[model samples]
Target chain A: MPVQLFGPVQVSDTVEIPERSGTAFTLEQGDTLIVIDPRGEQVADLLAFNAEDVAEIISSGRTFDYAETIYLTTGHELYSNRSRPMLGIIEDTVGRHDFLLTPCSYDTFHHFYPKLQPHRGCFGNLAAALEPYGIAPDMVPTAFNCFMNVPVDGATGKLRVLPPISKAGDHIAFRAHMDLIIGLTACSAPDSNGGTFKPIHYRIERG
Target chain B: MPVQLFGPVQVSDTVEIPERSGTAFTLEQGDTLIVIDPRGEQVADLLAFNAEDVAEIISSGRTFDYAETIYLTTGHELYSNRSRPMLGIIEDTVGRHDFLLTPCSYDTFHHFYPKLQPHRGCFGNLAAALEPYGIAPDMVPTAFNCFMNVPVDGATGKLRVLPPISKAGDHIAFRAHMDLIIGLTACSAPDSNGGTFKPIHYRIERG
Candidate 1:
């Protein structure tokens, strides 16, 4: 599917992360990264690091602490491990997102099937995407689970993976606070829309 | 690190899923599936289906209901969607394993880094592993997250990813109650043992 570009912003960089794959690019300060849930049923795992120091990467704990909410929506700022603002959700078509859920990995699939090996998980995808930038897998930290529906069971405090409540072409855009290296993984969890993981479309625009 | 094979169980099959990869296999009734966490840090996502009917596959929700606990240990029988016993854990070197979490996917990685395409996720791994048996991606379902440490906060009900408490060479073995097709994805999350995703060792034996 073609990548969709949002209006009014001067487009500088545009990339499309196909189903079960990843892409990497640099986002300058004030640049806007637009992530599209093309099919509206897919969830996108987002990870990022400051161009100056990777150690000060995205931290879900900090983001949640700063936002004072378990879920993220428009006007919320994503914080790095250093409690620094990295990206701000200036626009959000879908109101629900998961800041509480960690990224999925091979361990996740291996739980259901013992014979299989660790395949492409978000960790691997992020590692591969950041390899060129000298980023290590261990440096890849927590994420903002965009469009992922993880409702917390009030009684037992359990997390349920439900289908996205977003519509086709719905998206969330983040404004970069600094020069950043960003990665994207189209979630491949079966719970992600019952295994028919649709692709995600994204574009970076000059603000 | 080297791959370790357990005692004289007469291994009939052996497979290794490299970091960010997956494997698939089958076992007859009474056979055994051994999953080894060579580094004791990686998690394995497990998925299975009755050989006679793929629709009757392992279900995390059902397994949790039957096990009556979120963590998996020896003697816990994994249940299918129909709440039928599938794999019975005969032995466990590590007492703690998580069944509360779901597998990792591309959408997961893409959420943080926008440029990344979907790379390896358990769903892709399971599909690739089950392809020989004609299992499609959409058919790949939720998993039993083995060796994963997802501790939930009691007050806020948030999930936290932590390093596994398992030691090197730790393993978990399950005995098949019926003919079954299984898939596995090695846990590849950075939060999984600080990102040095060591390889996993596995073998099937005649019981």
Candidate 2:
């Protein structure tokens, strides 16, 4: 199981990704971004890209492939497209995560609530967050789902969605390897975290 | 088995996603993106996001969940995270496709070639293609793998990667349900397409 190590620190910046919205910020190399599931059930779409080039970003597939493990917690390094270390998990309060699933998007809600057109989702939230940086919504890529619950049936690989194991104030921290543009989205999926959507809080700490 | 249906049409756009690289293009609601494995062994990372909202992108988990199948081919509607139809598979010359696995990334290759250090992967390719639009590499989500073979051991759900069954010129086509920014990456994994990497050709056609 994953355990938290970094609990107290001097924070440089703290902000909340409003329910169903997204946030973007910058973190210098060696800095750490702490993603907090304030309510214990909400999921956060955690994404990062090289400050100079967006093409070299963190890849969940590679993270799992290199780790040779399905679950991630402290000590795991999130790798970029070029295999460069992007972030290292220095602390994690919740060991269970859903790197296997993509963040919920408008189309995901439409699958169940077609009549509720333009439903909010993590995909939209991230796009909105990146817009100020001149990134078009269509160019936004997939995300690394943090705090999401997706349990795989070890016997069959069948996935079962569940509520997050985090508690209020539970957080995870990553030490950046390069200057990064961090994008985050507060997941709004009704099925996430026990059929309710919640907000997320985060902070960046630099030495 | 999935079968091809649409054929012999004027190409609106024809381009090659070179081996170890990625390509990004646009397709209107009625337009179709035809991915061609020129040498019949290359795997393509197929991804798409709403032209209006990048967050409304494709999700392999939802696609398989809604389709109720692990394999994808003709007749399957590539659903977005919201469960709305994004692309409809009108044709598939090669019936076997992988939706259960995430796209290859730097970490994925490092597992086998730690010394290779900077092994190229589909994740980086896609991130590059979206660079012009300001979408960072970390934002490139999981992908729909086309043509690469991944045989599932039924009882165990153990995935065994294999060479593509498609011959040269084998292809797949998807009719967009909405305006879309489609991304494609020619997988460069050493084990892809029978131990050799190849290029992929694609074209968009409008009714």
lDDT of each: 0.72, 0.75
Give the per-residue lDDT digits (tens) of candidate 2, residues A1-207. 232366544455468777878888888998888899988888888878788887676665556446655567789888775667899989999877766565667666776557665565777777778777666654444466787776655434456668888899999998989999888988877776677778899988764
Q: Model 2, residue B49: what's the lDDT?
A: 81
Q: What tens digits encode model 1's per-residue C-alpha lDDT throughout A2-77?
A: 3357554656544667787777788899999999988778888898888987656776645653454566788889
**What's the true lDDT of residue B136 in model 2?**
60
Query: What TM-score against the true fold does each predicted structure earn?
Result: 0.50, 0.66
Note the DockQ of each predicted structure. Answer: 0.04, 0.19
lDDT of 2 by residue, B1-207 (tens): 222366544446468777778888888888878899998888998888888877676876567556645577789898876567999999999888876556676667767657665665777777778777666665666678898776654333345678989899999999989998888988878776687877889887765
- Docking quality tier of model 1: incorrect
Cα RMSD for candidates in order = 14.4, 6.7
| TM match of model 1 to true structure | 0.50
